[model samples]
Target: MTNLGKWTARLAVIVILVLAFVAMLWWDPRPHFERVRQDHVVHFVVFYALMLSLVLSLPKLPVWAIAISLFALSVLLEFVQPYFGRECSLSDILTNLITVAVATFPIWIGKTIRPSDN
Candidate 1:
């Protein structure tokens, strides 16, 4: 695909992910799960994975920019949670960072294995 097309796709994915995260905050499932501890971790894992996937999808985006965006988004979400009756925790931010790091490792490996001709 062309660069513009790729960028458009990545932007769309980021919007969808933000919307989904907001929806989750507004409509939590912990009440139905009956085990808040486990449910919270599950939610964190799923959200982190989605965030990591979005970060990895934009191969042309700088790693530092991706990391900063991820951190900023995490902070934004935390600040917004109170409006939706949700409480944010530092653990969630840590989990997100770990997942993003794990997702980025493959990209790092690929670059190291195939250095550019330039």
Candidate 2:
């Protein structure tokens, strides 16, 4: 695929994933509450996908910027969960950070081992 086409497709996926994340976090809960383990898994998987998508879409952008921006967004979402009648907890934030760290670790390692020319 051409670079433009690839970028467009990646951006579309990122948008869809982000919308799903917001909807899952902000929308009313289902009739049955999810188990704690299930909830953590959901957070981990979604955030991991989000972090990876972001890195792929904006490869030129510094990894730290992407990680920090996503972490901030996660924290903001957690804070707003209570207003949506959902429980807000620190574990969710920690899960998000761990996801960010894991997803971005390779980029960090690559940059360290092979310093950028620019």
Candidate 3:
């Protein structure tokens, strides 16, 4: 594929992932589950998936921009949760950061090891 095609495909994937995340947040079905123990695991999985998606989608994006965007999105979701009968928590924000860091660590290491273009 050409560079343009590859980028377009990547952008499409990113958009789809973002839409899925929004849907999940908007239609949380945790209350229907009988087991509280499982809810925590589900939440962690979903947030981690979002973090991973962000890491994979924003390779060319500036690191600070990516971090700021993730933080803002997390905060927005947390704040919006109240209307959906969910409580916002700092721990969730921290977890999202951790997950993003974990997902991007390998990319960071790879860049560091590669020879500079200059």
What lDDT score belongs to each candidate, Candidate 1 first? 0.65, 0.78, 0.64
Over 4 Å off in model 2, which ranges?
1-34, 114-118
Residues 18-60 of candidate 1: C-alpha lDDT, one tens digit per residue:
7656656654553454655554565565555565556548666
Task: Please report, as a residue range, the 10-residue window in candidate 3 with the lowest summed lDDT.
Answer: 30-39
TM-score per candidate = 0.57, 0.70, 0.58
Name the TM-score of candidate 2.
Answer: 0.70
Clashing pairs in 1: none
Once fitted onto the true fold, the runs of candidate 1 whose alpha carbons sit more than 4 angstroms away are 1-28, 31-57, 115-118
Candidate 2, residues 24-109, lDDT tens digits: the string is: 68433532355666676777778877777776777788899999999999999989988988777898899999989988898688
Candidate 2 pairs with clashing backbones: none
TM-score of 3: 0.58
Q: Please, what are the lDDT tens digits per residue for candidate 3 over residues 1-118? A: 5799778867866775766566466544644445443444455556556655655565576655665677688789888988988877676677666756665566567667867644
Candidate 2 clashes: the total is 0
Give the CA lDDT, 0 to 100, for residue 91 in model 3.
66
Residue 71, model 2, lDDT: 95
Q: How accurate is candidate 3 locally (lDDT)?
A: 0.64
Q: What is the C-alpha RMSD of each candidate to the true structure, in Å?
A: 5.3, 5.0, 4.9
